[model samples]
Target: MSKDVQERGLEIRKSVLGAEYVEAAFRSADDFNLPMQELVTEYCWGAVWGRETLSLKTRSMLNLAMIATLNRPHELRLHVRGALRNGVSKDEIREIFMQVAVYAGVPAGVDAFRLAREVFDADKDA
Candidate 1:
């Protein structure tokens, strides 16, 4: 059962985060982090992202907002790329960060924008 969910999660994770990102994660996993990786794959991506109530784009937006609210710059950077791949427009992402600014504090929003800029610029380069 966990295996099935993990497999599904791996598929969703690869699709949203890109094969390169997911592959790098797996490639970097070791004794200490491998379990954590499997848990996230099974639970986060499989259980949450695999749900049908919301589309992938909506989930990506939610992730962006929540990650920004938490002030998790690293995750925010990663999810910014995922959000774009999921069909979220750059303007929409800016608006989402604006909402974060209003509710999650200006600092959080500012940092989120900074991280987003890095991701957007990388996309331009790629």
Candidate 2:
């Protein structure tokens, strides 16, 4: 990818995930994992998220459902926070999980709710 794409990705990633979180991710990257980080920043955040066809709020909601369906609690938790930052309401998130329960499985919905709650509680404590 071009330097411009990478820079845009980094900016968007930081805006969505928080500058501290993105900086820490880069800070902890080793030789083995650095490439993975670069790919995620450049491709996932820049190439995909940079597109203006869909709003960031829409993307965050879609990510929440897909990540929940895939049973990725870590990514789900991160995206839950991002979702809120992107203006996705808690009620909307609950509805998304409820939909996940119907199609994806009750277990997936349960885990998504639990992870979301953890993120919510952590923010409260912070």
- Over the stretch 1-126, how does candidate 2's per-residue lDDT look in tens digits? 799889999999999999999999999999999999999999999999998999999999999999999999888989999999999999999999999999999999999999999999999999
C-alpha TM-score for every candidate? 0.96, 0.98
lDDT: worst 10-residue window of model 1: 1-10
Candidate 2 stretches greater than 4 Å from native: none
- Model 1, 12-114: lDDT tens digits are 9999988998999989999999999888999999998988999999999999999999988888888999999999999999999999999999999999999
TM-score of 1: 0.96
What TM-score does model 2 achieve against the real structure? 0.98
Query: Which ten-residue region of model 2 has the weakest summed lDDT?
Result: 1-10
Off by over 4 Å in 1: none
TM-score winner: 2
